[model samples]
Target: MEKVINAALCFDGNETQKTEWLDAIFSDVDRHYGYSNSFEKAIETTAGLMPQAFLNRVFQGTEEQQNRRSFFIRHGGIRRSPLSKIDVTDLIAWCQQRNTPEIWGLVASGIMLWEKADANENGYFLTTSAVTFLEAAPDPEPVLHAYADRVTPSGWTGSRADTMQPRADAIAELSLHVRQDISDAARSTSNRLAMEIERERIRDRQRDEDREQRFE
Candidate 1:
């Protein structure tokens, strides 16, 4: 998944300069997944559906935070047994086992700051670009559905869809998560701003009252 994200980065970036991301992805996948699974092929497989922006955000944290994210991504975003869900203690313990003793608070903050999952809290269902490396992806069969309308004054109206592909399902799940995250952030920010505005208004009223008392 990291390799796939890095390959997505490769698509976004200019080839002129050296980058750490491109470096790591190329080194690991070719050596492991064989030359058949080239980065280009990976990107092509995940073209329109990849949550490129959200996956990039996963790498935007501190070095230690990035390590935590790496583990989460590798596990396909499942917070397995004993953990129940993505809890702070579980992540810290996991990191400790790997000898990555980054501050527990920092790890906790990372989880809260970036975590988004289903309503059931079952999985952090973003950036599941699994088709790249996996030889046998869930339900490889492509289910296509198409609709066409008669052309009137408004030219032609038609659409194509891969109705049921594992990759498409992954992408749709990601879109829902991203949308909910954005909505929640916007609501939280707006609420905070409103509270601040009300606080300022109360302060202004108190200041006016105090001035009147002084004048009297």
Candidate 2:
């Protein structure tokens, strides 16, 4: 069976309602391409794309897990912070329209749980109430603030003054460079996957032709 799986977001509802939503989502997905047995299986298939080290951090409940989850959200173009109020119904609608992979939803749900738990070191329970709130709330707006308005020291005055400005500039430059690099890498990976998919289609077509010729 193909390893990849897709899932839709679940919104606020009672146990029966939630189960019905999930069932509908799964049934729709299966109608297109039958592979996944349940939402958990779909999520696991999505998680399988990550490096083992990253998966380790996620499962270990370490601070690194938060960073990784944040990275996924950012890279996936989910601009709003998980800490902000999110409308679950809108999110589910968006995911269904886009056919978003289940993995992204899993990461997002994890981030919500993390934020709700107040970054508790021990980890938070994934209660049904929390999931309901996540799905039922309205989509959050971007939190905009002017950087210049924030309080800061006028200038460096100590012995470190000479190097501080240059160091800061270099760090800022490197941050931009790293971001560009990541974008390029993601694009390259996407292109490669597309090529592989096309090749598979060509092979399937060729196999069908061969079978038809043999019968002739």
Candidate 3:
């Protein structure tokens, strides 16, 4: 709201509207009020992070859940458009339209739940960890940056050119995660095999012990 009020001075609104709405900003401002340099940068930095924007649009009750479920039925995994994909046959790209690979990776890692009725028919329906992740996110980044910049200030800097380096780094990090996920899946399979072998050996030993005790 404070950002909106200040931005209006340079952007849009009548004299009366600006005069009245200027009060929407605090008469006195703080460091936090000037967190982002401008509105455009603020929107980009805080994508899917604003609870006020998200909560209002979120599905609430059974009827609304069912309403959204119908859309998921038509498409897959809340992905509204198939045209955005690199190729329509590229299932991963299609899925990435809404939920990133990290979200799907978490589900694949067994930290969350997933289901598919068919090839394109999917339900991501993961809640508990998702709720926790959402709650923990908003508390840190701004505060951490503020304190970290005591010597050299670099608060919310989406407006800066340095942001491009971070973006490239993020893509590189995500690519590494793909390999990590593959290794994790292979480890899970190997561990499952080891578990079954142990169980079979234990069963054999127990059976032999029981037979010996019967003879005694």
Please list the C-alpha lDDT of all candidates, in the order they appear: 0.33, 0.34, 0.30
- Flag clash pairs in model 1: none
Candidate 2 regions with alpha-carbon error over 4 angstroms: 1-83, 106-111, 115-123, 127-216
RMSD per prediction, one decimal?
20.2, 22.5, 21.2
On lDDT, the leading prediction is: 2
lDDT of 3 by residue, 1-216 (tens): 435534554454476764443222212112222222333322321222222222222123355443442232222222221112112122223234434333332212211212222466322232233223322322222212221122111344422323223222222222222345433433443344345445645666787789899999
Stretches of candidate 1 off by over 4 Å are 1-178
TM-score of 3: 0.20
What lDDT, from 0 to 1, does candidate 3 have?
0.30
Q: Which ten-residue region of model 3 has the weakest summed lDDT?
A: 144-153
Ranking of predictions according to lDDT: 2, 1, 3
Candidate 3 residue runs with Cα over 4 Å from true position: 1-94, 98-181, 204-216
Question: Which consecutive 10 residues in model 1 have the weakest lDDT in total?
Answer: 143-152
